[model samples]
Target: MVVTNIAFIPARGGSKRLPRKNILPFLGKPIIGHTVLAALQTQLFDRVVVSTEDTEIAAVVSQWDVEVDQRSHALAGDSVSVVEVCLDFLDRTYKNRLPDTMVVLYATAPLRRAEDIQSVMNLLDEDCHFAMAVSVCHWPVHQVLKNHGDHVVPVFPELIHSKRSQWDRYYLDNGSTYAVHVDAFQREKTFYGHRLKIHEMPRARSIDIDTVEDFEWARYQAERMLL
Candidate 1:
């Protein structure tokens, strides 16, 4: 049937805590232009790349005409892992043709929609190979704590002081959507790999913008849920 969805957006630049954060400015677009316009309004991507080593985020994601894989300053570091810039854009643009779905969108999680990435590609059926977009970990994930220099501890140390309403209804990975199955991502290249499925957004669209108070609380929830 020749289906091939490929919306990989990993805008890397020198962001040491939000400098040039994927072309900043949010509510009037620029934050990877609303994640490349929610992967082109989820007309279920045939291709909507953006792997940037930054030529002004590859000229603002080539003005949404998409394709801009110019990465490799040794995969543009800061310990490069958007799964190694998504296997370096599937080993440089689908080498020898391999794309039967691989969406990873995360331009700092711009208020995920476009039916929250087509409902995580409608759970990518056929015994699943991965799909994502979780939320509802509204703090107190089993009293998580760390830093052990005369201070905190319980990072799930037996869920210390456990408030188990079944571990407080947890769910996370709201790193704004993902989907897999490029043959189980070339055999488990990992996005929590095989057989996974989920799609439960709504921590007001799961904000993932790093600091500056999470870009002013995702611009106050994108001005009350992006118009």
Candidate 2:
């Protein structure tokens, strides 16, 4: 089916890495504000809904110019997979009136720019299983090492002997944005199913907020961008 309307944004309340990081105050508003603003800026989807079980978070989202898909408590646990959250949100919010497309935007991705969102949306097609934002990292895979029991092994052993980083280039899942067809998600819960599309964004714009340090870094980056 051809895709037009999309609705989905996973923002659970609990976070072991950085407790309540999703609703944490950023520069002037909650962390999710940036994501909501970016989503609105794109003006691509018919409706943008934030999926969460927390009333406070839902209240904050209501303050924004978008709808809220108040999630169930069981689905809000840390153990819940993002795919599960997205599926549930879609089922409950739209019922049988599912959209042709569904895009899942993570609230932790504060640095995801409005332009990048628009760029990824442009890549969405009926044939595409999924499409997401990706960015190239400065580090080489050869530099990564892993501890294997008693021995430290090269994360990518083959890359250890590689001459140039360019020849062994790798892209990181920026976690900034994702757009998927509704039918594709029903078939495969993952964004990268059988046929996935890639939309590259600037590495600086893909800063996913996780810790206090990450928040500070995002602030610094945002300030820098403003200047």
Candidate 3:
């Protein structure tokens, strides 16, 4: 049976770290524009929807020729989770016509490619409830440091003596893309479900723009990749 897929992008206006991050210009188009375009280019999703409370963001999404779901004021706060935005979009727009699968694309992930999005969706099987993009940890846990009062402490003090090769490799959520079975997502109300799969992405493509420095790096990387 052919499964229906919908792509949902949540972009709120209130960004404390980087103001107007969703609509911020990355290369030439806004940051969210790249995500919408990538989702559309995959041609795997039946519908591409942008959930935003900001009119400017909605307008930018409209320019991409995709549907926009006006997010509720209650769900527009910084504390509101991405899952909440997606659930709100489903309840408000697709109450009766729910899709078989949902792909949550991050607006700030300008370097996320269409192939990566497709790969994550393809990773989701009948038994799997969630598939997300992940990247190998840049540094071993033992090498990581934390600040505690006036002292600098190792994040994994117990493993400080352990060689990096001694420990199993670790992966971190890239926050670029996520795919979920709609029924499972609705029931669990989260991306993490019983059966989960991960699509490993290269660190270069896994850059999540949350600050001006990150955005600049992404822009430089995107330009280089384009060339």
Clashes of each: 0, 0, 0
Report the C-alpha displacement of residue 166, candidate 3, in angstroms.
0.7
RMSD of candidates 1 onward, in order: 16.5, 2.4, 2.4
List where candidate 3 sits over 4 angstroms from the true fold. 1-3, 145-157
lDDT of 2 by residue, 1-227 (tens): 43367646788888878889988887788889888988888888788888888888888888877888778899988688888888777666565556877777889988887888877777876666688899986676676898999989888776687777346557888887888877778778887777777888777677888888888888888888872
State in Å the error of residue 153, model 1.
33
lDDT of 2: 0.80
Error (Å) of candidate 2 at residue 8 is 1.7
Candidate 1, 24-59: lDDT as tens digits: 888787877888887898788877888877788888
Between candidates 2 and 3, the lDDT winner: 3
Report the poorest 10 consecutive residues by lDDT, candidate 3: 88-97
**What is the Cα-based lDDT of residue 92 in candidate 1?**
65
In model 2, which residue pairs have backbone atoms overlapping below 3 Å?
none
- TM-score versus the correct structure, for each prediction: 0.32, 0.91, 0.91
